[model samples]
Target: MIELDGVSFWYRGRPDPVFADVSLSIGEGELVLFAGRTGAGKSTLLGTVNGLVPHFTGGHLEGAVSVAGQRTDEHPPREFAHLVGVVGQDPLAGFVTDTVEEELAYGMEQLGLAPQVMRRRVEETLDLLGIAELRRRPLRTLSGGQQQRVAIGSVLTTHPKVLVLDEPTSALDPTAAEDVLATLARLVHDLGTTVLMAEHRMERVVPFVDRVVHVPGDGGVVDGAPAAVLRTMPIAPPIVQLGKLAGWDPLPLSVRDARRLAGPLRADLPAPAQPEAHAGAEVLTASGVVVTYGQTVAVRAVDLRLRAGEVLAMMGRNGSGKSSLLWAVQGSGPRRSGRVRVAGVDPKELPAAEARAVVGLVPQTASDLLYLETVGAECAAADAESAADPGRCRALLDRIAPGIAAGKHPRDLSEGQRLALVLAIQLTAAPRVMLLDEPTRGLDYTAKAALSGVLRDLARDGHAIVVATHDVEFVATTADRAIVMAEGEIVTDGPAREVLGSSPAFATQVAKILGEPWTTVAEVAAAVDASAGRVR
Candidate 1:
């Protein structure tokens, strides 16, 4: 369904091609997965299929690219809308309508689909994507995850032969991610719809794919059987690592496969190490926190307290008030009634500079914090604002994610790289309390590990940290405590292991495979080593 021959593309700029001498073919009814580190041109490749690369994006394209027997270069993106359905990373940016129902039907209307056909397809897509309940909700008011569902539904209603999704599940909860992937699987198997997906979270999509297209950092591509490719990939999911450690003949990609081999390993391994509780004096406190917009209450009365060295994770569905509470605590977002004290002062009452010194927040849209023309300029501005050394912000950015070009525009950076840049800027303030909302949205495993290390070190330095995220793996690795919120109320709060282990929706792959409370591969690996020592 998709073919590229000697295809190479590079933006009109100073240097280098994004892809050079690349050739690939994806057959009809096949589910292909594109895997690579962040900013490795994965999205650029996906764009080429629908002619968004050189056509809409203003890049130079060489060689032939075709989808459904139509040359992409010969046709505009709209010309192939009936054949190719593309959903990008930021669903909100692509929205043209205010309500979910209208957004879904808008594409069909453009195609001049008959009203009866459009109505039936809209209903089918809404049901297919499990977004029926959200039909009448305004697009602007929906959470990130809900917006993603609506984006996918908008394209699926057209019954396009090809579907290209970029990180479709990044904003979704685990359950929602699974449901969407399962629906895609059915489309590939039952409807013969060709699907191509690019995702950083390999564990979720790798198992279900028929082919894996591995894109190494050198602007190249390699394709092979999923097992063969994943085995050699430097970055892999936890289960793959577990299989490597245990010397399993074939590495397991899914929890079920790993669980089959986990029987003996689970019994032989010792108890996993537990993080020590934080007993330091509270560095941040929020009492009776309530946030409302118009008639809608985003957050109800909720109380929260954080110790200096605590790593607290706020977990909940999208729009569960996690972001509201974090923003309120940071003394920036609207709060109807609440008292927040950080470092012995209410940040809300302090001057802007003083409040920033007391608390730091890296919001969901990390790019909002960046306004300079280039990375170097942004770093210089951060240093100037914090009154730190000229190179301090640059140094921090290097530590977070190395090798970012200082001359490149912040807007040009990949989602993950932009996030790292913003995070570095926020860290320069050296606030006593820090809050990050959905920081892992675009990060790969390697970047996430680096972020976890950074956050863990900050916690050790007695910085109170609160992270509101859907990345359970990140929470399991970084957070010492977990707080579950629902409709603005704290439902469960306890040790990270206990909270993540008991809930099926929030448990990590290790916890699921072991059928126990362990939350990470490190914990399991440590237990196995201890068991080996005892046996010896």
Candidate 2:
């Protein structure tokens, strides 16, 4: 239902096009995945479908684009609203109403649908995306994952023939991510909707897609069946990598397939690497922490202690008080009752500036921290705020994520790039205690690896690190300790390997393949190498 013929696009004043000579087509009822690293033009390609590329983004468009028998170059997005429904990566930017129910109705109201019809469609969408409980909640009050599902429901309510989503499951927990993907699959099967999505978490959708379209960041796009395209793709999920390691005839793209081919390899593997135990002096402590919002207790009597050189991961479902606990411990959010000290000083009792020096937090909503127009301006402001040497923030940004255009608006950046910018800005302060909330939401595998390295470096330098996240694989690789929370309380706390390696719901793909305490591809590789050395 969507077709692009020799489409080449470039922004004003840029020499190289983001992508060139990209000819592709998507048939009705097909779910297509756009796979690529961050800032590799995946989002740019999705924009072309709804005429947001040359129309809203102010770019040069070459060749013809047609969607649902409508020419995109000739018609604007509003005219094709019924034919195409587009949801960007950031949901808050597109919201026009205060409450969840109103936001869902706003899109249909714009289409001039009957009030009764809009109400029915709104209810149906609320149930479809699993946001029925959030119908009355304020848009600002919902967690990031809740907002993501709401954003998706807002578009799905329109019930357009074609649905274009950018990282639909990036903010969702694993269960929620699976539900959203299953919802999309149902749309493709029952409603005959054409679904096109861009996602970095390949493992979630690779098994459910009808086809794969890879944008390799070199002005070329490759489209084929999942197995055909994934065999040689540089980036892939752990299941695919395991398939390659075992020399399977066809690369297994899912866990079930990989399991059938993994018996021999798993039998020959060495014992999993044991993680280091950190019992350094306590650098940060939270006692009797109680956070509340009116009648709701967001965090209930939680006590946490962080030692220098320790990497702690706060694990939980969305709205399970992970973010609330992180913010309270950092002395920013509502802490009705708590004693939080960083380096022997009570951060909550200090000035905001001084508190920031003692505890730096990269909030889940990373973009809100950035107000400046461009990356350069944000970097400069961070340096000035921290009283650091000029260009320190900019230098740190490059070290974290190279090739981010300094002149580009922070909002205009990809979700991953924007997160990196905020992280780099926070790190410039060099606080004794560092906290990151959902830092891997938009980062690719390589960017995540780089972040893991950075976090490890900080821990080794005697900085206390705590991360609140839903990404289990990331937790397995980066954190030394894991703490699981539910209903504003900690349910489990232990070594990262023990916590992640034992939980079936939260274990990494590698751990699933080996049925052991393994967590990372590198660890598995080390074990495999050791076994091979013994055999030799």
Candidate 3:
């Protein structure tokens, strides 16, 4: 379905080529995953598939590239539209209509499909994407995940033979991301549509991928079966790590396979530890919180109480009111209907200085808060916001990411590094209640470990921490409690392990395999050792 021979590309004015001598091929009905760090040419490589390389993003392109039996350079973008459907990282940048139904139909209408055909295609796609309820909703009103699903559905309606999605789930919550990936899997299995997607979140998509194209930053690419290529990469999912360590051949990708492999080893697993009882002290509490748009309610009659020395993880699908709930607590969302007490102060009613002093929020888009020239300077400026000591901020940054550049522009740093800067600033203030929204969105394993340590330190120091995130592994490793919300209401609240462990459909496959429900490899190994009468 696609072919690339010795393809090398470089953006204009850049010192080095993002990819050089990269060759790959994807056969019919192949679901290939392209993965790498941010700005490692993941998106640039996908652009080559649908004639966006030399066409839309004008750059030096050398090599023979063919798609759907036609040479890519010879065909215009419109010509390849029927052969390739491209969905970008940002869904709002691609939207053309006001409502979900219209957005899905717009592409088909442009393709000269009959009105009846377009309507049928739109309805089918909406249902296929599990977004039928959003058909009548405004595009702007939908959450990031919902907008992304709509973006894919719009492209899918064109009846393209191949689909290209670049970081489609980057903005989605865990459950919503799973739904989108599941939908893609069904398309590949049932409709025979070939898929080529580039994403940073490999854990959710690795199981379904037939092949993986490992893009190296130094202008090289490794293409092979996922099991073979992933073994040689700098990063691999937890299940793959377990497979490598346990000496399993052809490392299992799915949770069921991992479970089968590790089930017999269950007796060697340690028993679940009993949670320490809470003293019923409220560190952060909210009541009658309400956020609404023109007429639609986003968060309605919400109430929550978080205790000191506790890590609370909020989980839900997109548009399930997770972020809105945190925003209300942070005193930044729409008109409020009730009281939000953080560290015994009503944030919504308190003055700006007093409110921020009580509750510090690390926003989802960390970049929006960063304006300084360097990582060190950014942290220093934030530390200066409340006359926070310089040594404290430096220590926090060093603890989170050692040997990080203090001179390079914050804009030039990786997504994970920028997030660390934001976190470091939040820690300097030492608020009694810390609010982190999607804190682990772009973290690597090492950075995630560093973040876990920081959050754990805060919790141990008796600071109430409420983290709204989709990173299940982070929640498993750090959070003490789990809060599930849906349709503007809290659905469940309980201990983290008890709540997440119950979900056979959603918990980490590696945990299921180890029979320990441990979120990190270190914990898994610890459990195995404990079973062998060893102590850490």
**The candidate that achieves the highest TM-score relative to the unseen native structure:** 1
* Alpha-carbon deviation at 306 in model 3, angstroms: 2.0
- Candidate 1 per-residue lDDT, tens place, 61-126, comes to 998999989999899888888899999888898999999999999999999989999999988988
How does model 1 score by TM-score? 0.97
lDDT of each: 0.88, 0.88, 0.80
Query: TM-score, each model?
Result: 0.97, 0.96, 0.87
Ranking by lDDT: 1, 2, 3
RMSD (Cα, Å) of model 1: 1.5
Candidate 2, overall lDDT? Answer: 0.88
Reference-based lDDT, residue 484, model 2: 94
**Which pairs clash (backbone N, Cα, C closer than 3 Å) in model 1?**
none
439, model 2: CA deviation in Å?
0.7
In the range 22-108, model 3's lDDT, one tens digit per residue, is 888788888999876544677778888888887987878889788878988898777888889999766777998899999998888
Poorest 10 consecutive residues of model 3 by lDDT? 514-523
